[model samples]
Target: MEKLLKAERISYHADGKKVLENCHIELRRGEIVLLLGPNGSGKTTFFKCIAGILKHSGNVFVDGVNASKMKAHERFRLGVVYSPEKMRVAENLSVKENLAITGDVNEAVEFFPELKKLLKLKAGNLSGGERQLVVLARSLISKPKYLLLDEPFAGLSEKAFERVLKILVEKSEEMGIAIITHERVESVLPYVTRVYSILSGKIVSVIEENFEKELKRYLLID
Candidate 1:
């Protein structure tokens, strides 16, 4: 249960407007943490800051190493992987070629065999769901110690969502995982160990498993 990542008094601003202020978070190894928030609640911004894609005023430590002080590639060596909501694959490359280009072809194929069959197909020709699976597979190939997912379940059918969720849970058991989602929390409630609700750029509340009943009361889910 050691802390793999910690943030203290973090703040960020854009266009002279504050996006996050005095926010704090701690992520322990082998735990699945869900970040729940409405749109523009700063969930995406917070993850980007942690991933070193954005600059913020605060202390972010990955395995006790200051994230801001480390170079982007150095942070990747520490097993921090962030998968944004949008796809970033090369349209001209084949599915397998894209994985190879990312240096994760072997591992990705092992996790998602469905992609293995479509290895020769161009990425641009794949369905949205298939493309997402490739992204998920690639993220796992990084063998990240901390995985940050932004709306990973978006644009998936129920069956596909369950399949992806299964992979996420399996991977989380091996590493720390944080997911930000605005969809129904119930879909992932059973697998989540803790939950943080963000509102207006601040963490409104932190809920643990022990407070399940109370949390549901607050969520108004009968």
Candidate 2:
């Protein structure tokens, strides 16, 4: 069977500058793939392309069906969800309202029980970490088959990170996850089934074994 979500020969350009060059990736259910790269490595650009936020030269296949022409909303309906690095929510709306726009608020809270109490609070009034949780919760409630998260651990406290990471591991059983994180790489190392390293908008290597050593090599850690 084809991978749940696949992107092939993905290349992108902006202002006549090539940002991504023939990048490819495959995500399978029951696995978490970690994308590691430094800043300005086209990490965010790749996620945007996969989420259909930006048009690029490539084909995106979802479960053997071509979805390259689908709009962002159309892709969302097809069970592909992307949570950006920055928090995105209606400032004036309450947390519950935000989640309700896509799916059941109660179902979303099941993943982050801490959100239950803050449901009534205006999204803008919450702290950065709280807002991140809301964004993640909303994504989870939609029950997407493939999830692309950009910097999901940003602004999260250690305790909160643990909670979120645990929930993500559990959710990976039902969905394929591709996460981009530059900090605390070791924290996510154990849970990831595959690792991809990108530099200058190109995937340099993919490691499925000897993760720590291989990852350090790409990261240039001594």
Worst 10 residues of 2 by lDDT: 213-222
Flag regions of model 2 displaced more than 4 Å: 1-3, 220-222
Q: What local lDDT score does residue 120 receive in model 2, on the 0 to 100 scale? A: 93
Q: Model 2, 78-184: lDDT tens per residue?
A: 78899988878888999999999879998888788889999999999999999999988888888899999998988899998998999999999999999998767
Reference-based TM-score of each model: 0.90, 0.96
Off by over 4 Å in 1: 1-3, 210-222
What C-alpha lDDT does candidate 2 achieve relative to the native structure?
Answer: 0.88
Measure candidate 1: CA RMSD: 2.2
Clash pairs (backbone) in predicted model 2: none
Best by TM-score: 2
**Positional deviation of residue 169's Cα in model 1 after best superposition, in angstroms:** 1.4
- Each candidate's number of clashing pairs is 0, 0
Instruction: Give per-residue CA lDDT, model 1, range 149-189, as digits (tens).
Output: 88888777788888888888887777899998755567788
lDDT of each: 0.80, 0.88
- TM-score: model 2 vs. ground truth: 0.96
